[model samples]
Target chain A: EADIYQTPRYLVIGTGKKITLECSQTMGHDKMYWYQQDPGMELHLIHYSYGVNSTEKGDLSSESTVSRIRTEHFPLTLESARPSHTSQYLCASSDSWMLSVPQYFGPGTRLLVL
Target chain B: AQKVTQAQTEISVVEKEDVTLDCVYETRDTTYYLFWYKQPPSGELVFLIRRNSFDEQNEISGRYSWNFQKSTSSFNFTITASQVVDSAVYFCALSGTGNQFYFGTGTSLTVIP
Candidate 1:
């Protein structure tokens, strides 16, 4: 089993509320990523980090922001949650510093903004 | 631009039957990588297999196998004697230039027992 964990497996919040989705990995991986996926749809890369203090935007633009202050923790925060942000958020980690490495994923957090 | 396409949106197979998932990709980079991931109803992705661009050899593990063909730009997955537990959404991905990964629109497989 993968050591990666996402807190609050399910969340239901009202619009304009502040929400933070936490992701932590105990595997000591150097690369981490955040993806947004809808039911029966493809996963869209929203954010990723090469390492601590390194963050980059992904192919799909997102309103949420991610921070990589610690190696094991990568947190995503939405300042003002909206109905559009209601989707499943997936967190993943890769051991390899290079791309194309197989990634281990955590049980995604399903968010619903009312 | 790198893209992965899974033409079949859903596939149904009875227990002990075999099913193949089609994946076609487009990439200009010669040193790209193709991947297959399985996502059950639980909503977590499980890495099934990864194939580098230089390797065109077919790979098989247990009852699962992958066929990679550079000529057709396709990486297909086949499962033999599939069980009810094999029911899930399968996604094909491509990691091309800059290590960016692109995912397919997943194929939902239902194996009725």
Candidate 2:
């Protein structure tokens, strides 16, 4: 099945710990995005990648960074975690050349920093 | 600048009743796209419908229908004969350059059986 996947659906970590949220898609999409959302709140874009070796920050400023080493993989890493970083991280991918296609989303990873 | 707005914060309707979720958007690009997504308790977004700037045609799928009005800058979704499964957070989004999507705050819906 071609779908987006995120690892460690739920995570709990202490503040100052280093963490990486993994995201992969089997759909072979070229554009991938990472979004942060609080429980029952709106989603905010944090990072995105156009393709391999291309990454960019999103509208909302985030302490985490992302890398796109492959077309199907985009991972986000936080050097030092904080309580403020506790939120659900969602991964999405869309076709590169399609203008009207909707993005395909993966089940979010819920992180808790104590 | 691209922005999407869902004026209704929350709504509750009894089963079998009809419900409508409103979506308004703003953008400078002449060519753009609009989308609606459903987020269930599982927290994954499911795409419902997509429309373009030039297409004003209304669409219906099963018990769901969408109204796209470029004149009012609105693209609304209506679910007829609501069911418990229809309860979820509905979001409206706008893609101005097709590279970025601007999402609304989302409207949470509850259906009472």
Residue pairs in clash, model 1: none
Give interface RMSD, per candidate: 1.2, 1.2
Tens-place lDDT per residue, model 1, B1-113, is 78899999999999999999999999999798899999999999999899999999999999999999999999999999999999999999998777777899999999999
In the range A1-110, model 2's lDDT, one tens digit per residue, is 23999988999999999999999999889999999999778889999988999999998999999999999999999999999999999999998656687888999999
Chain A TM-scores of all predicted models: 0.97, 0.96
Colliding residue pairs in candidate 2:
none
